[model samples]
Target: MNEVLDDPVSQTMIDIHCHVLPETDDGSVSLEESVEMCRMAAADGIKTIVATPHLFDGVHPPPSRDDIRRKIDLVMEASGGVVEIVPGGETRYSHEIFQEARDKHTRIRLNGSSYMLLEFDFMMVPPNIEMTIFQILQAGLTPVIAHPERNARIQLKPEILVGLIERGAYAQIDAGSLLGSFGKECETSVKQILRAGLAHFLASDGHHQDRRRPLLSKAVSIAAEIGGERYAKALVEDNPLALIQDRGIPFQPEPDLAALRGRAKKKAAKSWYAFWR
Candidate 1:
């Protein structure tokens, strides 16, 4: 006898980070743009997208939870239910963020799970990043470092990311970085992270319909080329779905130290040359 059972929800592609919430941050401009972003994501085979708007309390205040819900509802309706939108925030590292998530006073989580998207400044990793990661873990939430490859500090010191991953945090690679949209450094660092098996998720980090658009499908092939087919599939699907469902992610590969050291040396040499120039 063949008993077949499958949950469609569990077998869908999930984008853990995106900036598609209209008027929330620097993502989509209006409700129309948000709907269009969702449409684009659905067309590109993304079944779920976490609208992770920039959430910096004093710097870039995010929309209220109710407001975010309204926008998501609007976009979901506009997308004709082809895609699912969830409220989340791309929170910059701060000492107070963990408590904020614990209180449930805001949407700091990825779809109300313990998995939170933590972003750093594009230029540098904060001096207290290690302490902050500790704090997040203490609060019983897993911090998913958003786009470490794009940070200049991580690009210069790739080992810093290895340390972060070792400290029990996951790293999410941006699809744009894989496609060399940002620059060579970002692309190289992302490949190194993937090759080393340190990267846990791949997201679009989408902003608008055109430039920073949602193109996660393209990253799947690149991830396979760099990290093998299984790791690439997990990056886009399995791992992200686990976070969404509040379950343990099934895949966590050991980091390749030899590859990390090679990337570190190359990055160091590049930085030293730029300094002399």
Candidate 2:
């Protein structure tokens, strides 16, 4: 059993998605920055952090599994074990993902668990996304969609994510989104997702120690107001711990799909009425 499981109070928060690996991508730029980010996370009550650098984003070359593992060790050593750092990647959606799934790529999985942190384009959902998710599931891995609330397409039609959740995919909301760092549209969408119980994890997509620093307490407070304390805590603590352990999310509640659909229709009707006015 994970040590955290033995002492729930000690491991009160676990961040499953973060870009804390120095120089791996666009996250922490140097070893000093990575160590600072770890300290920030530990100070914010995050006991465990999955260092998810970007992968297959057409920007940085994908870090090898050994590279990721080695970087994690470096960060952990530099940080003096302030927080437990684990290997993972914020994998961009691509045809290559299918092959990765088939091979059960450990580097892309969170802490080499069955859970993969999947990222889509910010402006659009990928073509045949449901089928893609199905393929990932069929390969015996769960795709945890990262920051769906910030996606332009999902913002316009929140119910689109409901369908993905129903298809066995989980959603992770960025801590910054909850704190309104992404703007009003993202904040509103994240609240709707939380209230409807569509969000399965709350992660700090922290890229730097100062700007998008690793923190979850502020967001968890806002989430508690939107979905109550139990659900809010589950997003950052129980759910994430379960994910890294390759276990089913213990706090998952049936998403209120009907509510999301209804709200979308109402918004559409209002937009149409305003168009004529």
Estimate the TM-score of every prediction: 0.91, 0.93
| Winning model by TM-score | 2
Candidate 1's displacement at residue 35, Å, is 1.7
- List the candidate 1 regions with Cα displacement exceeding 4 Å: 1-11, 57-59, 268-277
Tens-place lDDT per residue, model 1, 1-277, is: 0011122223258999998877877789987888777767776778889888887745667677788788889887766766788878888877568658677545788888888899887888888778888888887788999999999888777889988888889999999999999989789889988998989999999999988897698888999998899999999999999999989888998988898888677767978999999
Model 2: lDDT of residue 234: 94
Instruction: Judge candidate 2 against the unseen true structure and give its global Cα lDDT, from 0 to 1.
Output: 0.89
Span of ten consecutive residues with least summed lDDT in model 2:
1-10
Write candidate 2's Cα lDDT for 49-158 as tens digits.
99898999999999999999899999998777878988888999987787787766567888878999999999999879999999899988899999999999998888
Model 2: colliding residue pairs: none
Cand. 1 Cα-lDDT: 0.83
RMSD of each: 4.8, 3.6
